[model samples]
Target: MSESKDFLRSIVEEDLKSGKYKEVITRFPPEPNGFPHIGHAKSICINFGIASDYNGHCNLRMDDTNPTKEETKYVEALKDAVQWLGFDWGKNVYYTSDYFQKIYNYAVELIKMGKAYVDSVDEEQMREYRGTVTEAGKRSEYANRTVEENLELFEKMKNGEFKDGEHVLRAKIDMGAANMKLRDPLLYRIRHVNHHRTGDEWSIYPMYDFAHCLSDYIEGVTHSICTLEFENNRDIYNWVLDTLGLELPRPYQHEFARLGINYTVMSKRKLLELVEEGKVSGWDDPRMPTIAGYKRRGYTKESILNFCDQIGIAKANSMVDVAQLEFCIRDDLNTKVPRVLTVLDPLKVTIVNYEGSEVIDAPYYPHDVPKEGSRDIPFSNEIYIERDDFNENPPKGYFRLTPEQPVRLRHGFIISCKEVIKDETGKVVELKVEYHADSKSGSDTSGIKVKSAIQWVSAKEAIKAEVRVYDRLYANEAPESLEDLNSSSLTVIKDALIEPAIVTEKIDERFQFERQGYFYADPIDYTDEKPVFNKIVGLKDSWGKKTAPKQESKTESKKQAKNEQVVGTEVAMSDEQQALFDKYTSELKLNAEVSNIIARDEKLSSFYADALAELNSPVGIANIVVTEVARELKEKEANELNFTAKQVSQLVKMVDDKTISSKIAKQVFEEMVKSGDNPDKIVEAKGLVQISDPSVISPIIAEVIEKNPDNVEKFKAGNNKLLGFFVGQVLKATGGKANPQVVNKLVAQALK
Candidate 1:
């Protein structure tokens, strides 16, 4: 472990350096009354991360002070979740109940010291005595009780001599203190309910405030890092330690803002209500913000940790854009997860020209990644493509399949749509297509080009699977603002067909369906024959529709005039006009402000018309000119923007190789916006290159191990923590020249 000098770490470092304590210790005390959420992840990471980084020890303590709400089941689940997050509590695991006798003796000691007494004030009376922010509270009549009498009463109350809520032990602190928590807070209360761990032995329990500070002192914790809400309670925390004259360690408290996303209510109580009221499936529902939920939804722990790091500990409360979280997951999954194709909404397509009994063995990965062997996918004359891929009446900029339009069938041959096969209801049931044998993907033939390449699965070899395409649980960015009891935001698509290649032994694994986005195997519902996958998050935010300009040709205008005269009414707008209308309607939505409410609305319509009137291109205006642009000007934090719609769309385009590689595109994108320059110009000036060549990375890895002799020795000595140090030094040596994947593999081999 190394010395940490961050705000919280600095406190610990100063304490240790000044001989405040011989050794450092910390505790991650969670109340085991409910399942932990992403907010809890921050506390877990901070406590355990700091301890590990500083060579200190962290205790996984359950503050099960409230017997009525706490349970053994919750305790077990919490422990399992903490371990799953890749943290160990070591040998210092404890419960507040474990120190019941010790805490009782401390309370008796306080009573004898004239610092605490048993009070008969009921709940309502006690609340009244604990005055508001502007006023001071009056002392209770029991505040000056004799030590002999207080001790006798406290013992009897604990021995079942008093009914529940009749008597409580309270500290004799100043009622005039500005902080409400120090106004003679309750130390112990009579609870007749049976305890989960210590059954029937005692009828009283300690409150959180009383138990927490003392637990830290008893365990010799150096720092008590907690969320910002507990900032005001620091006074009472220190008072308890100071009055007792105990051998307290550093135990200095530091507050960090809790993690709050745009569309989430991080409150444990509200989350529980959502689970109980059937708004979500369970604690592990893919839509939930719980760690288990995220894990099931294909979010890697590394991604989560990176996200926490990016949204560093701050003093002020801030709402982190959910896009940042998604970005973290995408960045992590993109490198590790293998790509595959699966169609959710299928429309059958038959190649009339192609001969029968033909099969193609298409390679899976475009770039060779070690350990991920290729699979043979059967391609026949018939296949299923996305229903939305084809349109009967094509509009301008519609690049996908249409009448007489040629499109590449992913890894198969280039095909042209000849005719549409329809049912009696005028619904398109199938498409008749002709394939060019010379334009087979692997065959080197000239003059083969298409505007669109659509994904497909062979109808004969396709596997029937349940693909749960999950969207935002609420249509609104902030669903918590909805007052309706039935305003649930989740939708589930039950049936889907996927390529057989995806059904290998790693069917339980997660993969990106190329253009479709990321998905995870449903652990509960998936089977060998029928796989079920849940859409974790989309490749890009595809919530809104694209609008095209209306066409008014001379021939159509004459027919429209005749129809208008017959009904004495003007003809309604065309499909393009209606699309524009819908877009405007979307921009007008007055939903809650979580993400970019204004930009999301603007994206819904032709509001860009007004925007473009003041700018050059409507597309450019829509992308680069918005409230977010202004927000970046004011705050300089791109993450604090209300919406990331433009950034997300650009990222998708970059990945598709429209302009530059994703790595360079990201760097240029950030710089262009910050410096107010053209993206293309910035890319040229910086000469930011994406290192895809593995040959260049091999030597750099060897050099990195040679340079960091100490870290190399540590790695060989079973100090796996130093592996990251080697990676960092390798990245630095190359000036980030080496490809990370190649460097990781080469370094692992060198160490072995």
Candidate 2:
């Protein structure tokens, strides 16, 4: 498809083609009162994206009419965020403060032309006159003020002749118009406060309605793109331009829908509240929807742009699923991040029979990646595997390690559990396993076929890293509707043991722990020795587990068992127990056949069986099969679901694994469904694999240096700003495949 014809572009194109305007000019006029958020990013992208597509100029104009809230800090952050998103306003940067003199002159001219007048009404009285949406507002008593008197009062208001909000200048528009914005809206407000840029030069500032259109005209902006909220204001935008009688290209306003996502509050006021109330760390909090927040959280500009493209422009407002946003992140990250292993929740496993002196070389990427490079990762008698991998009494259809089952220690040897060591609290402290020396990884002679391969990090070379496991900021999909403000959903796991490779100088890189999800070094908090990593998004979808019906079923089953015992002595059931039984019986009546089918499936683990019985909804299973499984199959473009019905059914059986988040998992499943690829392979190829291993990525740093000589030279030439350039080059070289934090550290080392 051609890039020059987005919806807004098409409008501009039609306008230009029809000779409505000889040249197309646009402006991104941000109110410099607050930092730009992700919502603003969409506007920036739309405005600049359209202007660039149409070969037009876009002015970066600051709508600083509200000097009470506007600040230079916000202006700088806005500029940075726009540039970071890869758009340029060139030399057309402007401020409304720059046109204060002109705007004041225009207001005076309007008063002289009997198009404006001085109003003595207070703020409350003004609102009373500017009636409700359905009612016509009462005309101001001062509406018919003579031009000479109106102009004189307006000048007095500008010359600090009155206190703020005492007397104001209003446009002499109709008060009975259906659109309330045109009801003699204030052209200028009396504010004695010092302006951030203009200082105490004037007392009156032009209102948004009056100054915005005039500023656009002064800059010769041909098209003024704004959100749909301004649709009604379009009339006024044109009025100010037409009244000026300016022969310049008067800008036409086009409105597009503002982007909104589920579970997110996009209002700048609410976002600021989040920051001020300490709900989030700052504006750049990964949990925040701000552009800076996303950048800090390891999102790429390309991914954000791609998401905008997928959502497309719409004339009406709509809410986009947060899953789609995550999908784009995973899609971009997967293609670019490299695969590595780092255990977040660590449990020690002793290979009892293996010699303590043993160490092996593991290739950073798969053998197919470079085909020649491999780094030595120390392997010994002791290693740490995920605690969830082992089950004392193995459940039905469980394929991971158990009492007698042998499992492959990824990139190492096959090990069989011989003993489970427990601490004083009776918790399994460690696992004693015996390894087959002959069954080394990459050696087929051992002839060992295990049911599953578990990932591990050697305890001897492990790095004590802080791993932050981030969940959704809100527990509810529609958090804005909820009244409770205390429901925080973020969990930070600080004590995580990772591979020694992770402890290397490349602390800022992202690494995919094999069988785990993607993770990135927390750039703001991480250091070379004690790296802190944030779980960008998990490898799987676990949201269903928290809200799954299994808990209710367990409670119901227990209640039934207790009621039956009580009824042995007494004949009547309590109201609550009877209600529970009735509900259960009703469910059985509704889905007996599907429930029977699930009960008869011997291959399904007890966990899933209970979940199915509790859920008692065939629709749940059907959704899992169709939406989750089938969708995954389609994403992977598989000929058939080859993993197995047991494997497919087991998804519901086990509590949702925390390897990947539900958001990330849904995205991964979508990719799998479309491509017919294994989850690991899909994740590896796409950089969706979370990096938990430091050792594996430490060496990938060397490879990044070998690949980018230009960036290395730039870094050494004292152009430190080129650090991001190097990071971008590394990411580009890896196809967004390498962990960026690791790339940053490694690039720094190579340059030094």
Candidate 3:
């Protein structure tokens, strides 16, 4: 939001600071041949943002010069995408067709000045004559046509005397120019195709290189901004503007790096191919990188703009991790959207002790999100939970429903599984449980506790919906170059169950589906009769395991203790390690283990200092630096991380402040390590945050209690040693950061 630090902005700022331009004016010119993608979003922000910051104006110019590829549909889609990004062009919207006559007059003036001529080279011959980057082009024989003859021929060409590609107008610049773009580029091409806007008014259309610069000049665009691909075209841009002897203060072209996302190809041609071939549903397919695609996928306008801002304009070309973009949207939605519960793979649970149904009042703002509202969801003896929530033969650390484990029914009471009913095929058909009669969510008299609480929808009140989970369209980093694509990008679940409130919610509303992921009503498919929702992203990075404390055996501890000061025992320490170690331990108050590991590396020390600068919490950062960062540094050098110390510090602070759990932090840290990206970005991109608010965590814990009846019995029968085991289970179930103190107290009360 502050003055942009991008190279393009620096020039604009210098121009503004100086009296060169009274007011800045810029334009977002799209060819209107295809739908705009995330690449255009960056340009829109740059051009429009600069103009806005300087109190100037920006024009939305649809470059409909080549009407053969342009269409009314594309123009509308472009406008919709711009508006969806929360920008307005006001009365500054214009089309290249609007300036056809003016540009024609400029071309005529060039003919008069003998700076242009008519050429009759065929398309194939022109390609042969137009030399490569390393070669000088051969001049066309028709380049020397007399000005009077050229003017007459041009008039005849415009009058429809020339067939398509039979004749062309060429600038008379040097043929031997090193820049092929400047080697007498074609100023106009004869095309008999009717224009989308002009409609047969002229047989010839001015080329983009000729029309673009002139359009900017005509509209008083002070700064003509484009992507790096157009850098070579700037020479011809200036030549046309200068050759016509245009008025003073002509628009100057500036280029910056375009947005390139991993696993996303922004080529309009490729994207169109995908749509036409049914590789994707349409241009607005949530998997596509197009602006419309993101909008339909529950990505907020604020998030896209934030993403553009974070990946600010640069001159150099680079591939940005898509996680950065995801982070932006997730961060924006986190505190604003309410949380909801939906089960994609439903498994029925029968509470044997409860006879009838009841209504539980649950806060819509159960999570950390700052919201206010409550919804009455039906709670009955019969409910549908996620199929994966129950495991008959549970893993060692599994915290959800087991054969004899008690778990809490979120927003209701604690329940323990009494029996597991299976079909003939051995698939879990139903789970019979008994609920703690007095353990109501609020104002409970029955002492009950849980390690995990699983969400469930009342079987009687459940709403059936089709849920679509979308993943990266391309599994490879650069799918543009690779032939292989991710064929399984979209997975459709036909029988997901949602609470009653989801049916009444408006389209495009975002909600965290409890332990699942953030989802939104499909803008086009969602309906009252048969609802559809798209899983925007999962709660954690679905790609990896959650962060758990690394257990050390007594032998390993003894080994580490014996070689505490030995170099390269686990990692090589630098000569500066002692000083940094003392400083962090005594001055910064960081733990010994973390300081010992981090001080050995200059990059880690700098990262530590930077993180310390942003966050005052040393222990929080130390935990990550020692465990997560050290693990990464063991194999690679610090420079390879591609992240700054400030990013590390911010991530540490997020965990220290309990914005996300240590388990969730591990997921974020993994992404950061892989991409060398910012921690905040990884968290946002992956939705790796811990929900510690009582409203959300209480239900999850209750489910854990009810699912583990045998553990509860043991604790009650003088086996107090199971307390730590119960706490570990709760932590594991809740992604490892469940307000430990709160879970401990609740567990103690439940066993009482």
Give me the candidate number with maximum TM-score.
Answer: 1
What ordering of candidates by lDDT runs from best to worst? 3, 1, 2
**Candidate 3's residue-wise lDDT over 1-752, tens digit each?**
33115677788889988878988999999999999999999989988888876778999999998978989989999899888876779865799999999999999999999899999988899999988888888989998788889999999999999888899999999878988888889999888898888899989999999999999999999999988999999999999998888888889999898888877898988988899888888989999888888878888888888789767778888998786676566556655666677888888998898997778888776333345787888998899888877889875555667877877777788888899999999999998998888888776687654555678999988999998888778755567633546656788999999998877754237787876667888889888889888878654332211111237553564455455532111222344665676676556655333455567667667766766778887777766675567556656776676665677787777877777766677667666666888877676765656655777666766787797798788888999977876776777676565777677777677668
- Model 1 RMSD in Å is 9.9
> What TM-score quantifies how close candidate 2 is to the native fold?
0.74
Off by over 4 Å in 1: 1-5, 248-250, 366-372, 444-448, 475-488, 505-508, 542-751
Better of 2 and 3 by lDDT: 3
lDDT of 1 by residue, 80-150 (tens): 77887878898656998888899999999999999999999888998998888999998899887899999
Residue 292, candidate 1: how far off, in angstroms?
A: 1.2
The TM-score values for the models, in the order shown, are 0.77, 0.74, 0.75
TM-score, model 1 to reference: 0.77
Residue 12 lDDT in candidate 1: 74
For each of the candidates, give the backbone clash count: 8, 55, 24
Overlapping backbone residue pairs in candidate 1 total: 8
Task: State which candidate has the highest lDDT.
Answer: 3
Per-model lDDT: 0.70, 0.69, 0.78
